[model samples]
Target chain A: MKVLVTVKEVAEADDDFAIEGTDIAESDLEYDLNEWDDYAVEAAVQLAEAGIADEVVTVTVGRERTEETIRMALAKGADRAVRVWDEALDGAFADVASKVDLFEAVVAEEEPDLVLGGVQAADTGFGATGVALAERIGFEHAAVVNDLDVDADAGVAHVHRELEGGVEELTEVDLPAVLTVQTGLNEPRYASLRGIRQAQRKEIAAKDLSDLGLTADDVESSLTITSMYEPESESDAEMIEGDAGESADRLAEVLREKGVSA
Target chain B: MSVLVAAEHRRGALRDVSYEAITAGRELADARGADLHVAVIGGDVDGFAEDLNRDGVDAIHTVADGEEFDHNAYQAALSQLADGIDAGAVVLPNSVNGLDYAPALAEALGVPIVTDAVGMAYDDGLTVTREMYGSKVETTVDVAGDRFVLTVRGGEWPPAEGVGDAAIESVDVDVPESGARVTGFEEVGGGDVDIADADVLVSVGRGIEEEENIELIEDLADALGATLSASRPIVDNGWLPKNRQVGQSGKVVTPDVYIAVGISGAVQHVAGMKGSDTIVAINTDPNAPIFDIADYGIVGDLFDVVPELIDEFA
Candidate 1:
């Protein structure tokens, strides 16, 4: 079985994020593999190690910087890595449909038996790309999956979905499906020194829009960014000024005033 | 053109988020000078539709077909309704269930989608504001399409009031066979004490360091007569039951007083407790994002502050 996992590289903004033109300033911004996607990569690698899957392939869509993020996945035991990016894909970040379109193009090429992705990207937080990609590729899908049991022989996947209100629902889904994994599903293993060295020899393939047989117009963004601004503050926090004992006493007095304490 | 709002319901009762969606849908409809239509999909949802017949809604579309909240049934029903009414925009609560279908429904209707919308407006076109970088940065996006699907964040908009009686319209659509089926719901972390019902919450986060440290938090909770709650990490580590977990994936809570101990305030955790009347954050890091939304902040170690607070309350 071949499992394809999707990962993304997101920028961790400084406390004061500077707006550089239409986007956040790049300087002083640290980029890493999206925190959520780490679980997807971990799940894929575990399935491969357990012999439930033959190969684990990782894919991402971004510029050259994204190669480092994909390499992290490779070091973690993925068989191969693919990066899909083009100048046309720059504006696609504003909209998820175009991202879904690009992912559909990539998934068509890989032809994996199972697809896994983070429930949502740390940057966009849309939480819709995986499901949309499933629709685009004509595959059944599930989202926010915390527990998964796959029966490849029966071509079915049993999943435990984390719903609101601390409720969990167990569902059975047909195979050749997409699953958007939630966090805490498993503890992701770190790459060892030997694994890092071996990853250097592994293949990292790059594909652009033309290679996917798509042009800029075909993947035009369905959304635009008209403006950007900080959200208005409701109220500034009143910092208690004192040592721990004094501060606790002051907090108790405040709580009493608020009728929370007697 | 009309704006369609998907009403969320569990069992037979309408979820609070359904009304929140209506509130957002009403704003979009008024801005576009169009009608607002709401779709309620489930079994025996006539009562649910009536509850949705608020002042801003022009029509309430009800489909009594699915037994439970099935994602595929919702997608099929919503896509058909949106197409039938020629909806210019579709609005839903940015929830687990809503996110489940928003993408597939958008694909089915051949439209674009924007999820987790905190703010939205229409000026020649639709623009949505979304929080990124754990709410440290906000991005305003202009949806470049004639029609779009949006999942509005819960609790951002006030629930719509029922004033004008909306006409109930029964819509029939083919419910496709879903590849998945919900067997049943299993309550985790024990269901005895629901944090949502608590008036005061003493919530712990990763800063507690170890499972044994939870006793300190519990002692504080006992002294203050507050319910014991935790963030995702504590629950994931099995230090707390899933029922005591407070967050987007666990439970949304709005207690009268929320004392966040060692919580750095990630967006997901903040989404659940931001509605509290008074928020107190205790963390070692002064720059913790939890301080931004906290009504009161103590940039001291929780281990030090918590015991002091417990002693004071005692």
Candidate 2:
């Protein structure tokens, strides 16, 4: 089976960053392989290592700058990568449908038997794209999957969906499915020096909308950001001020006042 | 046009988010000058319908189906329900199951979807307020059309109370067989410690950095005479056990005093511990959401402050 993992390079804002128009200042935002997608990549790569998957290809909808993050997935063990970006997706909030469109196009071309992605992105945090893509492409899907066991012979993926609370629902999804992975699914391995060197030579196929036979209008987002600002601090926390020792003394005093101590 | 809310139930009990969704649904219904219709699908729908007949509810529609949540059933049933009611806006809980179907339902309806909405306003069109950068920055999203699906964050709206005279009706719907089959449910976090029983908790998070450094937190927990607990990442990393995890998917701790060390206070972690009597945060990032709910805070590195804190108690 061929597995395709959807990877994203999410931007996280630094503490005390300035808001520029509708987003955090570029200088203040740091990009990294989304924490969740890292696990998804590991899951896909593990499928290959287990001989359940013949190839593990990663697909992403990001700019050229994201190749570094995409290559990080390759170094960790994705065979190749496909990155799609266009000017239409530059500043707009790509709604769920818009993203599904991109992924659907890639899926049609790749024809992978299995698709995987993170449950949610750290930045947008929409938590919708994978399922939405499943709906669009007509495939079975399980979201928030913390445990995945693929039985290639039976063409079933036994997954544990981590519902709210401490309960997990065991579900068996047929092959040709999408599973949005949750964190803690697996420990993502760090890229070894040998793997990193090999990744430097791996192919990262960067494409525009036209390359996928898509037009700019096909990816227009219906949702727009009207305003962006820091949420006003609603905290009334009495912050302990001073050096570590002084703060520790104050915290201990507070703990003692709360009737807590050794 | 009406606002439709799909009530969620699991294991014969309605989740709190169902009532919360009713409140959110009424808000949008009122703003849109439409009736609020609540739909409860599957597993004792008749009983669920009665419980969902809260204030501002105009009607309750029940679709008898399977015992547990099946996204295929929800997407098919709710899509037909929303269509029948001509719901201009659909309000649902932003819970895990809700996310499973909301996006698909929105796609099926060919409308936009806004997930994890903390705030909403319907003047002419709709505007949603949601968090970004893990709740550091708040942004207002404008939906171009009046027809959209919104998944409201749990705890954002108070659950609707006071039973209203709502007309109950059973709606027959065609739910397609799915390629996914749920086999069973297993309860996790069964271990030695129940963090919920603790009076005082000294919780550690990712800021503890390495697995070996967790001993530092255990030392502090010992000196303070408090139980040692952790955030999700710590448990996820195997640095701590699931029994010691305090989060939405872990034990909900309402300790007398909760000390959050190196935890950035993600919403899931906050959901489990926000009810604690008192919260104290220690982290280098002053803007962490943990500090927002904390009664006391120390804006410094855990590495620097923890040893000193252990010394103070020693």
Candidate 3:
């Protein structure tokens, strides 16, 4: 079985940042492997380690700057990676459909038996790409899966979908499936020195829209980001102003006034 | 054109987000001069339909199906209804189940989708307001077409009240054979303590940095005679057990005092504890969303402040 995982390099705002246009200033944004995708990478790598999956491939829809982040996935045991980018993709926020268009093309070529991805990208938080991809590519899908057990013989993936309020629904999804993994499914491993050295020599197949037989028109996004701004703070909290000890003193007083005691 | 809002339910009861979606749907329907149609699929559909018949709802459609949410069934039923009603805007709850099917439903209908919407505006076209970068910034997205799908966040709007006499209809649709089957459900986060029972909750989050440092928080909780709880990451890291987790998927807590330590209030975490009577936030970043809902705040390092807090209580 060949397993494919969708990875993204998500952006995090600094302690204080500036907004430029419809996004945070690039200089103010720090990029890293999305925390959720790290778990997905680990899940796919484990399948390969267990010999159930012959290849563990990671696919990312990001710009050239995102290669550094994808390399981390390779170091953590993804066999290889495919980075999808194009000059056309730089415009308008790539909606869920646009991402599905790109991944659908890769799914056509790779034809992996299983696809794993994070429940949602931390930056976009749309949480829809994985399911949409499954729909477009005609694959089975389970979302917010917290536990997974794959049976290649039965062609079934037994998963526990994490629901709100501490409930998990156990489901069996047929093979050729997409599972959007949640955090804590497994502890993601750090890249070792040997793996880092090997990652530099490993292949990262870079493909553009044309390579995937897609054009700017095929991936044209109907969504436009009109404005960006910091949400106005509704806080009316009484800020305890002081150094640590001084603030603690006031906090103790406040806690006492609230009748808190041992 | 009509605005369709799909109501959500789990086990036996309709979720609050379903009512919230109704309120949001009404807003959109009013804006477009369109009728608001509410849909409830599976699990006591008739009961769900009655509860969903709130003011401004012009019609209600219920599909009698399985007991719980099956994305395939939801996708089929909603698509058929949307097509039948000629819906221009479909509003859905951006819950866990919502995420499971909304994208596919949009794809099936060949429409654009935006999830977790906090605000919306309809003028010449539809624009949605959503948070990004862990709620550090908000962005307004413009959809170029007249028809679209939206999954709305819970608690963003008031629940629809003052029941209406909506015309109820039973929609017959074919639920196709699915590749996924939900066999059973298991309740997690059940162990020693229930944080929901606590009056004062000392919750820790990512800022604690390491597992060993959780001791400091335990010490503080011990000193205050309070129960110790945590945000989702702490539980996700196995530093704290699920029972001690205070978040959407863990437990909803409304303690008298929710002392958030080293936690930047992510939306999910906030959903569980924002109802606390006296919310206190202690973090280095004053701009953290935790402070926005905090009743009292101390902008300082948890390392410096938490130990001192322990000493004061001791």
Best by DockQ: 3
Ranking by DockQ: 3, 2, 1
Over the stretch B99-195, how does candidate 3's per-residue lDDT look in tens digits?
9999999999999999999999999899999988989989999998899999999999899998898999998889999999999999998988889
List the RMSD of every prediction in angstroms. Answer: 2.9, 0.9, 0.8
Residue-by-residue lDDT tens digits, candidate 2, B1-314: 99999999999999999999999999888888999999999999999998999889999999999899999999988999888889989998899999889999999999999999999888989999999988889999999888999999999999999989999999888988899999999999988888889999999998888999999999999999999999989887988888898989898889999999999999999999999999999999988889899999999998999999889878
Candidate 1 vs 3: which has more TM-score: 3
Give the TM-score comparing model 2 with the true structure, all chains together.
0.99
lDDT of model 2 at residue B129? 98
Give a tens-digit lDDT track for model 1, residues B1-314: 89999988776678888999999999999999999999999877787877888888899889988667898889888888887889989999888888788998888888889899888778789888888766766788887766989999888899999665788988887987888878887767666798999999999999999999999999988988889999998887777878888887788899999999999898779878999999999888666789889999888888888888888778
Provide all candidates' interface root-mean-square deviations.
Answer: 2.9, 0.8, 0.7
Clashing pairs in 3: none
**DockQ of candidate 1 (2 decimals):** 0.57
TM-score of chain A of each: 0.92, 0.98, 0.99
| Deviation from native of the Cα of residue B285 in model 3, angstroms | 0.4
Which 10 consecutive positions of candidate 3 chain A have the poorest summed lDDT? A89-98
lDDT of 1: 0.85
Q: Fraction of true contacts reproduced, model 2?
A: 0.87
In candidate 1, stretches whose alpha carbon ends up further than 4 angstroms from where it belongs are A91-94, A242-249, A252-262, B191-200, B207-227, B237-239, B252-257, B274-278, B284-289, B301-314
Q: lDDT per residue, candidate 1, A1-262, as tens digits? A: 8999999998877666677665677884889988778989999999998899999998888888778778889999999998888887765554666778778888888899899999988766789988988888988998999888888899888998888777787888887899999887887789888878889899988899899988898788777665655556554899998898988888888877777642
